[model samples]
Target: MAHDVQHYNLDQKFDFTAATKKGLFTVLGIGAILLIIGIIMAIFGGGHAEAGAAEGHAFHWYQRLYANLWINNVYYTGIAIIGVFFFAIQYAAQAGWSAAIIRVMLSLGNWLPIAGVLMIVTFFVASHDLFHWTHASLFDKASADYDSIIDGKGAFFYWPMAKGTFPIFFVIRMVLFFGFWVFFFKKFQSLTYNEDLAGGTSSWYTIRSWSAYFLIFFAVSSSVAAWDWVMSIDTHWFSTLFGWYVFSSWFVAGLATMTLLILFLKGQGLLEMVNENHVHDLGKFIFGFTIFWTYLWFSQFLLIYYANIPEESVYFLERLSSDIYGPFIFVNLAMNFVLPFLLLMTRDSKRHGVFLKLVCLMIIAGHWVDFFLMVQPGTLGHNGGVGFMEVGMFLVYGAAFTFVVLSGLAKGKLVPKNHPMLEESYNHHI
Candidate 1:
């Protein structure tokens, strides 16, 4: 079907019709209401002092909000960063089949800088609730709140009081991570746009060269970013594979997101260049990464479980101990690993657009739960519960992300007309 189209003449611009704008706003508005309601539940949800609360050992309502906010922020950041990673890899490989869909990845990559800003703001706003090391008393030996474990790792995450700085190391690392991603994304985006105009190998060469450089930077920064943002939440617990683990989850989610978007466009009669061959490749990614994510998940779990180390085991222990999170721990594994592994294993399933989209959505939601388990157990302990706030925040971020990515897609040509591989991509087949 795709071979019949000698050239893609579809409107490259996204039409933000009144209905579309209304839909986006409605989602955002509904999210806001849900967020407010979630906050109320968090603040006053546990009616009368329960077992933990009655004992004066309960986590406060604000803590739950802080935890939820931080986790969602991290989840979105991973989604955005994965876009840059995807683009960088394709450029590095000089792969041609993706030239047409490259815009979707680039548009997705555009969200990183914005995600960076939101992450920084969230850290500051929820510092007390999220990181114990952020508190001055945690480092003060004389203070009752002093924690030796936090102090031990203070050189990296904690700033000295004499410097009168907050998150100096943390903030610097955050800035560097996002700065690296945003800088390379814009450079590559410009090269692609320029290639659309100039139609030469010069822009291509530059993109490929920079892609190699970006990948190296990604290897180090992605892990560190995960360590800084997510791992640090469990300040006392540590994992050697945490960075890779987070990266796997991020990569799969990114592929799933891009896949969903492509399907949506195809349904609307756009992306005539995109065929089942393209969808199949995407399914392979979602399938392969789902396993990779599971491997890391189990590897991390197995190593910790077998070693039986108190510090490391405590992370899972808290999650399992929680009435709310206990079941989700299995649910997280099932959605991310079990379901994707089973559903996407077949060749026909990968070729089926509808089935692949359903699996993609499930994997995306599963990872959210995976991330929620990673976060809530460490931060909220047994105090947390699924409610309006969690659902609403998901909508809020989803709406915001959709708006930004679509706006980006609208700004550029839907097809990379001048790309050297445009023909190859249009005729791609498995």
Candidate 2:
């Protein structure tokens, strides 16, 4: 069986039109309005304390909104970061099928550093509402707000010498994590771009070496990042598999985004080199990671349930006990696991463009819900819901994400001409 050896014009670049930017910014502008309104409501509107009620504190509307925005920022930023990892793994492994779409992956990765900055800003703004450890009174023995558990964990999250949970270590760790990821993201990106201008094996060797080390650094840093950013919200509850769970969610989401973009480009008469073989491989990844994510989810749940440990079980109890969140737990599972498993299980389905796109959409939404479940229950308790505020914040963040990535995509050629595997990628077949 002979497959058409498609030819690509390596000189072709994406022309992200001015109209597109205007439209995205308009959406972003609307989202900004909504976000501001949501923030005002949360700050001025009073409600029963959803978190920190033990010391007679009640959670404000701002705290819930902060949690919602934080989740969206982290979730979307994570997808971008994972794209770099996905590209790195492919480059390191010398995979040929993904070579044709490397630029798309690179564009996706350019959003990581920006996301890091946004996260820092949001943290400073909502430190009081999002992070319980930021409270000074919680660590004081003479203070009525004293928390023994948080005080004990001070060395891990706070400045040990200062004797309070002021988040010195936590903030430093955030800087380090994003700094390293951005550094490598730019390093690899520069090398790949240079390869297009100066085609040689020297750059490839350098990239391979950097990617090898990056994987190691990424593994440790990503896990610790998960602990600091999300898991630490609950403060008392801990899970060994939380890092893997977070990684799996971001990984699948990133692949889904890539797949959607590829399909879109193909429909636009661009990326003629990308064929069904590439699509099939992406589907396989989405399918495999969905299972991996489900495995970790179940493992985390079953152990906590069976052991009935007060500390571990509290996390689930908080989420499950909430009437608003209880139904979404099952919904999250169904969208992330059941839908993908059933849809992409067969070879034919993996190559079906429309079906794959639908599955990708579900996976993206499902993981958003997954991240929502992970953070909201801890921060907002039962106060959280999917409303206009949440939708507006998502639009604000999503429009920005789309704008940044598309801008990056337009800066470089759509394909890497100098890539050694270019020919193989163009001819890739199952």
Candidate 3:
């Protein structure tokens, strides 16, 4: 197909649509098995810490509860839920640079149901680690250590928060979150597909309506969802900044993933609908939001650290005290912040697909480290550094994430052909 140099660039068809290796899915299968075996081994392997003397409290199998499970499931599955609706957003906005890769975003977004299932499963597993509020002492009013926070809050945060509060209420909320994505995704997906079938403003009108509602849903749900999952880890500690923090990291990471995946697809000869223009746009995003995310990171850290408030400061204090985390704190900031900030500052760098690719790779790695720094110190404490558990967790999630995106690419046309501005996008050279 010869592209007209003026209004059209010969649309290059990407030939590489690699079949997702059956092995990758199988590996998740094996991981499920190993996860089960590992859980059991860990359980029995501990053959007996004397009751009430382990890790500042008694270790009980029953700690697994409703809210705990909810937290875990939402975190793991949220990438899909949030990703799809957001993709819809960029499209509804008629964003040109993002339009080329919108198909993959839709595909990854569709994986929300699967991710939701994973979230539910994690909730079930989490019931064991959390839910100490069920203890007789907390509710009995007889235990001296019992505080009003636990007792007064028990019915709300403890029982309801646990794995089985009101099964109906719990499932409804989860369903609603997933439902928002499913419905919005279908609306936009149908509209986009329709654009290809019928051109003009018809698709744009439908997309714009869907996008407005989607943003409403995105703002409300992301806030609640963040609290339900990550913030709940330290139920006692609160941060109004928490939700924004989660979004900053996930959004940037998802975009970087999109850019990298596009590059990978191009390498394999697929997404022919995409070209350097598309890549350049993605790179520009890499350059722009890399800075935005860093701002958010600094804002959060700066406020929390300077306030010197015990609750907020403890979060940082824990990180600095730990040998492993103490050092990575700077490295984490450097990669996620300083480096991307400096490197991606140039238009030339962003326009250079190869340079942008490196910047994106750096961003992705940086976000991973960000997650590591955020999670490890809190969960594993000083004793837990980057070890097998962390590595395995990364491998399992990383592979799963990869397989999901590729499988999504295989689902539809690589480029949205009938977008109202797609012609503009194709001819776009800036």
Candidate 4:
């Protein structure tokens, strides 16, 4: 597998500050639109919330639809935001090959604050509507006067505690996730920028320090965040490997997204410096992480299915029963595992821009399924499938997602010319 080096024709002093401002505006605009639409649907979801009614009960199909969309929106936000972690870790390790795309990752990573704000607002607005656990009054331990579903998990569904602890921890963790991202983003971004100008050893020293701290941060926090934000939607089900499961899904998807963005930019007549070698690395990551994702998915499923534990088995049970969801589960596996496993195995395929981009698209679509499966079960319950609301919301968020990324490109110089590994990345040929 050999790749001929390529170079961008853009000015050496490309200014991305305008692009960054534009992207920030686009993110805010799209996010604002989504927030408005989702809220409207959530508010009009049912007949109405009676002031004195304790055991509020109503079924609004539209509300369910809005909820799913909102969930997906929050999820995409989380994935995009967590990209900061990817950037920081790579920088901390002083990874040479990825230096070319570090600036792009930073642009995507900077979307964290906007995403986080939307998620928090959505949580409080419809807290009871989404999680049974959020409605503590519904779970009366003393008598059979309350909701049975909530009663089933009353022990862990402590209202007072959830009210106090849930938001506190969720916010704290969000802060931690972004706080780490911001610190590293600044440190590395600064170092990379400075290295470009100064050509000093201090840049390398700054990056080296991040690797040790990053692994520890990732190990402790990734699982906790996954458990609370993602796995907890079901509240009843739990998986020890859930953290790795989420991480693998996002890792591949995130890499593929970066690849797609580069290809997309190239189509728009930019990123000329990005070449076949970069595509090859992106393809390999897409392929490798897809396999890693599959391994985790299967390992978790096989063990849980074999154990036949009621608590664990229910996670899969919901998916196995639905029309849209059941088919989606298989598709997710096929795209994330079978397709990439076969396609990326051949060396030439990874380096071919057209082939690589198509497969990257497949991986992204598949992981969307991955996140959908993890969430839709707890959300829509039995026999859930595609509806107008889902499609409509997808339209809204998908556009917003696109707007955010493109606008973000103009934020800074596309190439991290000062990054210590920039030259290595530009010269890389594996």
lDDT of 4 by residue, 253-317 (tens): 77887787777666666666667888887787777778788889999999999999987898888
Measured by lDDT, the strongest candidate is 2
Which candidate, 3 or 4, has the higher lDDT? Answer: 4
Model 4 CA deviation exceeding 4 Å by range: 1-56, 143-167
Model 1 stretches with alpha carbons more than 4 Å out: 1-5, 46-58, 159-165
What TM-score does prediction 1 earn? 0.93
lDDT of 4 at 43: 55
Local accuracy of candidate 1 as per-residue lDDT tens digits, 1-430: 5454555583466565677768999999999999999888767666333423522455667777778888888898888878878887888999999988887887788787788888888888888677755667777788776788878888786454322146688888898888888899898888888887897788878888999999999999989988888888788899999999999988898899999988988887788879899999999989988989988998998999999999889898878877888889889888998889999999999999899889988988889888888787666656666789888888898889888888777777777677777777878898
**Residue range with the least summed lDDT across 10 consecutive positions in model 3:** 61-70
**Residue 328 error, candidate 3, Å:** 3.4
On residues 60-175, what C-alpha lDDT tens digit does candidate 2 reach at each position?
77777789878998899889888888878987898888988987886787788899898999998987778777778888999988889988988887664575636678889899
TM-score of each: 0.93, 0.94, 0.80, 0.80
Candidate 2, 42: how far from true, in Å?
A: 5.0
lDDT per prediction?
0.82, 0.85, 0.62, 0.66
- Residue 41's C-alpha lDDT in candidate 1? 74
Assess the local accuracy of residue 321 in candidate 4 as a C-alpha lDDT between 0 and 100: 63
